[model samples]
Target: MQKLQFEALRRIGLTLAVAQELIHLLEQHPGCIPVRVTEVHRETVRLDDGTQDLPARRMPSLARGLADQDDAVAVGDWGLARCDAHGDWWLTHCLQPFSALVRRDGDGLRHIVVSNVDTALLVMGLDLDFSLRRIERFLALVQASGVRPVVVLSKPDLCADMPRALAQLQARLPADVPHVVLDGRNAAAAEVLAPWLAPAQTLVLLGSSGAGKSTLANTLMGHAVQETGATREGDGRGRHTTTSRSLHRLPGGACLIDTPGVRTLRPDASEASLAASFNDVARLSLQCRFRDCQHRGEPGCAVREGVDGDRLNNFHKLQREMRRDTLTALERRQQLSEWKARGRAGRANLRAKRGE
Candidate 1:
């Protein structure tokens, strides 16, 4: 009976490693059963026991024990649940996800977008909503999470210059990263993205609002599973059609998670991850004369000479943002004081030189 149950869970994206982990967990908690989180609400989560969906709340102690609020729970998390005397299911233990897509907000809070996802469909509209910089940012975040990223250029039918757009993408993105152009509403989308939709695979659609993520999700699911909305005429930006993140079982046996469009995506990545994302700039930096070259008009700066000015500048910006996020409260205050002191000293020198 347990083997049958395990088989059912495997059909819903349970890997061998996770299954082994689950077996250990089951031994430790004989009263608890394994459940996969499908949707997470404010106070309750929707869990699947491979047969039925159950609305379960976290145990009070479980919620209180978590150090970070983001670690509480999220869609795609595999956990242990138990039914109480009142016939209500309660999630007691959350299994550590092998891969998690995380983003840090401006307030320095980490938000786990999705857990245990194998691939990220980095959806971007080919219309005015397209931007190479935004694609780079998404790529960085996906790579940081150790999830494979496939660039999906959505709404190809709506694009006026498909060739030019494709050319731009090929020129900017890494050659190894796969990208495909497809109209999400067309049935052909399934065929185009078939390579990544194999059984037991899990994927997440990530893009801004109006990027055709829902449309793609519906097409891939072979039904209207998610709602679609039109883009604004003035800006070509999408409306918030998907208000929450939810997982759906694809006919091909893979699991798909559709997320609400993010307004701000500050990647929760370290300096090493950022460097890996900007491989060209990082490689060039190694050849620079100074080990600590800022590449801002510095002598023998290979990065400044070799990389595109805009691309290099974006790398620098993201690097600074990553460093700033790692700083402590005291470190931030000291950095601010140093900046103020430098400003004051520079102003004084200018005044003296001007004979003030």
Candidate 2:
């Protein structure tokens, strides 16, 4: 009985410590729940509890308020806020993240997909969703987010020859990284991912629909909390079963955030993510004849020579795409800045004309 008491106390203390750390990260926010946000109504949010309804005002997230509201906080973050005297909750702030999976918004602002993520399970089903280009895009996003990316090949049951598909994926991935192929509905699959399932840790699933992201989240939860759907026969794309981002506590004590599978993921690449994701390309670029060589039909393009022609082409293609995305984002920001400047100037002119 004494040992049991000690263990209970220890657990409580550990939980408190984790909470405190998050609070500090949130700049000592007063009233936020630890759970993720699913559906945000005008005044409330539907959490995973299925019974507990959270007041939207009480959930402080990065998406809450900022100059760039388009890049709002995502589902998998640890939030900070407090309940008022009336038992109403109001979100005040959110904990800063160690690493975040971000993508640009339609307005060209950066948006957080998942925050404080330790592991990003880059999921792709064995069916039509499996594409090297898509995987590379995810890799860039993972690299940029400063998180470890583990390729998870889901829906093994759907694939007639798992080994062959796995082999193809393996050949495409960077040699240094690891990949896991598993049936998303199986508990044994979670067991394979146990290394990352540490207590108080957070992991997020990043994959297209039909890759079994919702199923994997269910497996980790030891029950079904999310909806699952079948893939389209024409293209093998799964319907977006999870319309919103939601967090679930795993049976193993790890936290898992399952999000809606985006049809297109536009990445906001950093130099580090670029280097890490495309190490081969970066390494070869150093040997180029021209310092500013774009590697496009340029003579003495080291990147083209060092890597396989196909691999180099793909690398250049992604790099070009990232550059284009970045430029577009920058241009959007510039336009906003100019508009704001014009507003300020207009106000100043009005004040000057009104001067006595």
Candidate 3:
């Protein structure tokens, strides 16, 4: 392993331990080089091999192993790149990520948003785009990925009452979670997010369109690296200025992955994350009368008595949603299995009939 290679990779969010591991893994396969994926596109991906960015595509061997060929790459992923006999580069293999942030499609299929992210900057504009419910949804998603959530209330300069808005939003979040209010376009905004932008840390910005995610990315990078668009005057909803997820290095010595504005985010989170995101409600539930108290009409329902009525309702609603999703997924799997079994039986019966 060359010292320069390791140092350059480290500056781009590769840990020393992971670099050594990649080196060892590559040693077994001669002529293969280590590279980190910086941007993922429909047909090709851009990788940084600790020296320069290289555009490559997945090899046929690599594509065959993926359930969806399009899922062959994502931002913040580490992969092995090898030049074919034709001198063209191909991503040979992707390293298993230590962590990944995923969300569900309308049909409930999971999709990777970003990988190897340590922190999630959950941005919400303090204008018409602000909603505690939306924040909770984002929190559940981030918590599920085991990523630290930092609530960033953007465009506070536009808010009529920044302090009041900040306090109200903070009241709804977990007390331990860190948050900051700032104007995403201001240069001072970068300083407010400095703690999470330390060397080698990879942070992702998540928020609705026009929520200032792209602006924040540009401000943090200390340049106009990301395209910024104006939000609708009526609703304050911004258009999708960022069409793709790309990883950019920040002046603060960290990697920042900015995603396109997501209008809706349905979390396919675990029960633990659900409870953690709604810690207050979860705590009240523990004090309820029965171990399985629904808290709707149960006697001695601490959740009903102590928690805010709307928040409690939202919590219950999310619980029901997760349960429904789990059941739906199971039923879908079972239906597929039954269909396969019936087809097999039908073929078997046809063979028996022919024999008769």
TM-score: which candidate is best?
1
Model 1: per-residue Cα lDDT at residue 117: 98
Query: What is each predicted model's overall lDDT from 0 to 1?
Result: 0.88, 0.69, 0.84
- What are the TM-scores, per candidate, against the unseen true structure? 0.93, 0.77, 0.88
Which is superior by lDDT, 2 or 3?
A: 3
Model 2 RMSD vs true structure? 10.4
Lowest-scoring 10 consecutive residues by lDDT in candidate 2? 1-10
Error of 1 at 10 (Å): 2.0
- State how far residue 113 of model 1 sits from its true place (Å): 1.1
Give me the overall lDDT of model 1. Answer: 0.88
lDDT of 2: 0.69
1-356 per-residue lDDT for model 1 (tens digits): 13327768876788887888888888888888888999999899899887788999988888887655547688999878999999999999988999999988776678899999999999999887898888989988999999999999998778898889898888778767899989999999999999999998999999999999999999988899888989999989999999999988898889999999964588988988888888888888899999999889889999888888887777887788788888888998999999999999999999999999
Residue 35 CA error for candidate 1 (Å)?
A: 0.9
* Model 3 regions more than 4 Å off: 1-4, 68-71, 328-356
